[model samples]
Target: MAFDYDLFVIGGGSGGVRAARLTAQDGHKVALAEESRMGGTCVIRGCVPKKLMVYASEYKESAELAQSYGWDFDLGPFDWPKFQQHLESELGRLENAYETNAEKAGVTIYKSRAVLKDAHTIELADGQTFTSKHILVAVGGHPNVPGLENADLGMVSDDVFTMREMPKKLMIVGGGYIGCEFAGIFNGLGTEVSMFIRKAQILRGFDDEARGHVADCMKMRGVTIHTGCSPTEMEKRNGRIWVKGSSGHEEEFDAVLWATGRNPSTKGLGLEEVGVRLDRGGAIEVDDHFQTAVPSIYALGDCIGRVELTPVAIREAVAFHKTVFGGEPTKMDYDLIPSATFTQPEMGTVGMTEEQAEERGPTLVYATAFRPMQMAFAGGEERVLFKMLVDKETRKVLGVTIVGPHAAEMIQMAAVAVKMGATKEDFDATVALHPTMAEEMVTMKEPVRTLD
Candidate 1:
């Protein structure tokens, strides 16, 4: 069979672009089609822009903290238009980079949506057809907006970056990382942020103590959190969004955001029609090697529902290339992958949760919560938490959870030790760096409680 290319990638996301570029660089003819921006979700709409906003939102408090430290300055109001202009420019630069890199690697770039017409054939949005020896799908996912009355009146996470004007009062629904992070972002930006969470606490499935600490910090920061609540309906009324909650409470806000969740972006890709099996959540199902049921096709990243982080997606792409193109048979390691939530008081975690470790065997838990030197010196009530979970028998550190400013930064280093299977005694043997919040990780001498 004559094939137009050796490989055809159906997405231009982090995973798809990497796969296409690598395969092309390996001297195989490859082509990639993207319906929208080349940088996909992470660069165009997700982490890059969101982290920039997080940084932008923190200046207000940073200025106040500076004043407490005897520095004098006045923090001006947030200028949304100016910030957004820069953000758009940065994203455009990133998209161009992705495209240029792929082209340099000798991959054909198509600015159109591509869908499967058969096991080895793709049909583009312009009715163009191409056949390939192999196909890779990395379409990623889309934010889910629940089916509620006038739900279209609410915006999703993707809509946040291009918002014309910052809302004076913002109502956010959902208890996941997205909802909590945005609550902090808007509240820090001077918006009256209110959160409606159905769960008892935000960040479900995370370390309980850490999540509780985050919720407390959010409350102290002036974000109103309504736990045990979810929106049942929403409508526009008098130039505002009126939301009715499942708990029968009603409220009005200038803007409402539905951060419920995201679903794999596999629609109209003609996946199942070509014998690609999809999970119940519409995520493409793949085996250990990221190979679909059909041998000629493969899938990875968010569309496969395996670790939906951008870095993880890139790793999967590398693994896919090694396995399929390089003959290395590599697989992405999902263990001990640290993650962070960029809230006002951030959270960083790696390895097992206390509950998961306890379920496996006896465990030892070491924890501390206190105001750090900087915050204490500034007379701020904010406290930082450091917790380590250890196996009672092996004495190995099972998990590490941190909640405070720069928790994300601290967790990255901690994850290295955890990934190496460092024991609690190894941590105790390391000398503590004095007067540092992270020193607590090494300084804790006793387990607060032992789980049997």
Candidate 2:
């Protein structure tokens, strides 16, 4: 095939850049197009900046604890503008790194939106057309703000990163990871945060016990979490957004972030003209090989809605390249994908939840909740929880979830074990790393001490 390129990828975020670079590695000509920065939402506006802010916000609590740890403290007020400037600078650095790495790896980078011309062609916004043997869409997902009264007063998580000013009172309208994270971030930063959620608890998809622990922590930290509540209408009065709830309750806030959900960014990419199947949520329908309805095209990352996590996107990119151009077929396995949230206490989970394990068979769930040893002298009033979901019959570990300091770092190694089918013996056989918080995960006398 005399193709303009072997692979033409759209939306140069994590997934697009990975796919383009991997295709180029296989000696195939590849080009990727992006409307925004190369680092995507995670680096620019979402995870990366948010996590830094989380740490910064926690400094207030940390400083308060320092006084009890034999240290006199003189903590100054946080300058939001200073943090924003630093965040923007860091985003620029990461974006530049991705660009340089892509160029060095022989991937042509296009800075524009891509409109699909057909099953195998896309026209860049700049009026350049490229025909490729494979067209991969990695546009990712965007924050979805539903149609609500006074919607203009409400913002999404994306806009919060660029908030005009630090809000005095914030009302978050959802209880998902995005909303809960911001609730903790702003509350830790001393903004009165009120979260109104429709469900009985936040983090609806996570394990029930972990979710309960977070909810308890949130309430204890003075952030008001309203469950079984929905906003009936919203109005603005005297420079604030006034929210009316279903139970005839009313509240006002300087900002309302509606982190209800995200939908795939496939609306204007011309999917329908080429018979690309999309689910009810607008997620691209793909087979096990990640091939779309159109044989020559594929899609990955948030847009595919398989895992919707960042690492899963990277994994899909590798599998797609190996399958198509590298003369090897690879299918992505989503069994034990790892993920983390940057809420106040932090949380990380991998593999199946206890609810998910129950679907397969009767499961043995091991769990531990306690204060970390490091915190004894640190004077922090936080709890570290470690949960392991295992199969009672087979003794295979089904999942690992941790909520505490460095949860993300510790969970990754445990994720590898779960993915590789590690059992109780595997964990017991490994030696403890000593005096570290991670050692707690392995040294629990009983996974969960019961009242037997």
**Candidate 2 residue runs with Cα over 4 Å from true position:** 378-380, 447-452
The lDDT per prediction is 0.94, 0.85
Q: Give the per-residue lDDT of model 1 (tens digit) for 1-452.
A: 89999999989999999999999999999999999999899999899999999999999998899999999877789999999999999999999999999999999999999999999999999999999999999999999988887999999999999999999999999989999999999999999999999988999999998999999999999999998999987888999999988888899999999999999999888999989999999999999999999999999999999899999999999999999999999989999999999987999999988889889989999999999988898999999999999999999999999999899999999999999999999999999998789999999988999888
Instruction: Please tell me which predicted candidate would have the highest lDDT against the true structure.
Output: 1
Judge candidate 1 against the unseen true structure and give its global Cα lDDT, from 0 to 1: 0.94
TM-score of each predicted structure versus truth: 0.99, 0.95
Which lDDT value does model 2 have at 273? 86
Q: Please provide, for model 2 over 1-452, each residue's C-alpha lDDT reduced to its tens digit, 9 standing for 90 to 100.
A: 68899889998888888888878876889898888888787777777888888888888887777786778869888789888888878888999998999988899988888989898889988898989988998989999887877787798888877876799998998899999999999998889999889999999999888988988888888889888888889988998889988767798888888989898999999887888999998999999988999999899999988788777888899999888887799989877788888776788999887778778877776787778776777855778888887777677788889998788888988888888899877887778899887876677646452211
